[model samples]
Target: MKTYDAIVIGAGPGGYPCAIRLAQLKQKTLCIEKESPGGVCLNWGCIPSKALIGAAHLYHKAKDADSMGIRVGSVEVDPEKLQDWKEGIVKRLTGGVRGLLKGNGADLMMGSARITGPRQVEVTQADGTVETIEATKGIVIATGSNTIELPSFKFDGKQIIGAKEAVSLREIPKRLLVIGGGIIGLELGMVYQSFGSELTVVEALPDLLTGIDPECTKIVERRLLKRGATIHKNAKASGYERLADGSISVKIDQDGKQITANVDVVLVAIGMRPNSRELGLEQVGVKVDQRGFVPADKFCRTNVPSIYAVGDVSGVPMLAHKATKEGEIAAEVIAGHKAEKDWVAIPSAVFTDPEIATVGLSEAEAKEKGIEILVGKFPFSALGKAMAMNETEGFVKIIADKTTKQVLGVHMVGPEVSAMISEAALALEMAAFLEDVSLTVHPHPTLGEAFMEAAAHAMGSAIHILNR
Candidate 1:
């Protein structure tokens, strides 16, 4: 039996970073993976999807370059080449992850792992070789999540598919019907929509991107509608049928009214469920929640003190950055350092047409909690950079406490808001007041200036826009 100080299973955004940090903390860490090094986020989901989104965005820009006085003769899309380029990026990043793990002194093992005991793991390698490893200190369960498949519309991998296949399409579908108007669905649906697919979205909820700021979602929704895409809210995709001509007719139920949408592809991106089954967690006496997530405390420790869980397998806000942070905290805790899952906010970004990024409490959430608030908003149209880029579509919103003037949240929907959200997260983390950001001098004519201006607006002292 091989023995180590700590063992991390899954090797995902959560597990790899945990293993690396453990090794960096001078712990003998063994990291095990059943698939590619970077897991779904790198190999299938985030990185690949973002590559496609970028390509689609550039293609749209190039096609509409005539307005910019740059007349392009022809715009062509080579789907095969685009996929190859995206795969190249995935390969490079996964390779880097492997190199980083090895360089950080973490032993990487390619195998499927099962918890046999509180401190014991049984690993089965590709060649059918089995080995039992022992962890003296801790065992971290970072097995992320899998896309939830609706039984009504099974994944055929071609006509009907999940996010995995959605990102790897060889050719753009002429007509695409997307079920579930959440992040993954809209992001990919917009990519193909930009690629000339007639897009239709069916969302079960009353609104799109549920739990996000509705005002921010409205901007993206309006853009989709302007581009000839149809959106059905409070709707459910009841079933789908494949026709003789290789087209699919999807039946949608919205407000008790039946509607049919025929398309070349159907993407079911409702949500993801934690991958927690058959890990032998029960055998080790680790308690898993009813939703299949392993419950972990602030220190990322499970009911069994020797075991821990992080990332999607642990709880909600199933984001890669959140997983990485938890992984680092777990590693620190295992190294006898004082670290816990303590943060003011866990920021989120939706890579829609015009990205939506948010940090801390939303205006509705604050109101729901019975807290009086002051809200400030600045449109991207007011920003010179947005006008220069010809992408003036959304706005930046800042929410603060009415009494304390403390920055409660920052929500943005505009170009590059994904990258611009870090400053908002920092403000929330530092508990910055409205004046703290308002008084700071931001670079002139930048998109980020909107944040400063929004803060100033909250205090009724905005310069560019009239304070209401």
Candidate 2:
């Protein structure tokens, strides 16, 4: 009968951070994991997929070497080799996560944990052995989510696959059908499309990257089309059937028109739901929503005083950063410290051919909320770096309150905007004003200057482009 000051379930981004912070606070913290430490983000979701995306980007650059004054012969991509590289990165990161937990003095238990009582948990080890542990202080559940699948088009892990399998596909199918236009679908589609696969994306939303700026999407969609990828918006995947030759016939309903496409593989990236059920939450009187999410307060505390839930198991906007933030807040609360969760900006990044990054409220959201705002935009075409790199296909736009001059949102669709969004997120978190950003001198010949320029535009003090 082992006892600890606090117990953290799941070893994903959120859970591991919570456990480490708790242990650092000198609390006897125990972390239980059913699988690897890095969870989906490192193992299957963000890391590995980004590796593949990087490889794909390199391949695209290589294909365009002629325009770059380089005479390179035709090159072909080996999906298996790419998979090996992606796997190596995953292994390295996962090892780092494990070391971080162990170094922080957090006891790591490799098993599945389930709540049996308010302060008790049962663990099922790999060898079918069961053990019970008691937590004197509190418990945190951070188990992440899995890919959502339609009942009709179930994943077989071969032909029909989730984002996990799609990341490590052994072969790049000749023709790939991606069902869903969400982040996962486009990221993976870009990977395969670069590897010589005829790619088609079917999204149920009327516009790709729903709720994003239509102008930004126009640039990305144009680029995708030029790269030989077909996009079908306002489309729903009905069903699929296997052919005699092992190919799949995918049926899609696009704006009430039925169309069939044949492909070697189909990826379902619709969305993800919380992984909160069957954890014996009912035994401990933990309440879960109909969608299997454990409702939590701003500090990640559930209805029960001593119980907390973080990560995908909590609800929407199930981002790894969000989970980690919640984890830190919960750990501090459990350590008897006064802490609060306050985030004015949570940036969203889409790693398509031309990346899309946004922080704070979108223009549509601001308008819907009845907030009077001034929008400013600076196209990458006017950027020196974008012209030099020949990647001038997007813009950076900033939205600010007209009266207060407070920056409300920052959106970008261009090269490496993902890395540039940290400034926007930090600025919003610190309650930055339009004048604050506009007067902040940005370095010349950088993409970030676009943000400063947009800020200037928002204030009607634009040096470049006509004064509105």
User: Worst lDDT window (10 residues) for model 1?
Assistant: 240-249
- lDDT scores in order: 0.95, 0.90
- Candidate 1 local lDDT, residue 202: 96
Candidate 1, residues 84-168, lDDT tens digits: the string is 9999999999999999999999999999999999999999999999999999999999999999999998998998899999999
* Structural similarity to truth (TM-score) of each candidate: 0.99, 0.98
| Per-residue C-alpha lDDT of model 2 across residues 1-468, encoded as one tens digit per residue | 999999999999889999999999999999999999888999999899889888888888888888979878978888778788889999999999889989999999899899998888899999999999999989999998988988988889999999989998988899999988877888889889888899999998888877778878888888889989988888888998889999999999987789999999999999898889779997788999999999999878888878899989988788898889889988999999987677876788889989999888888999999999999988898888889888888999999998999988999999999999999998898899999999999998898999999999887897876658
Off by over 4 Å in 2: none
Candidate 1 regions with alpha-carbon error over 4 angstroms: none
* Best model number under TM-score: 1
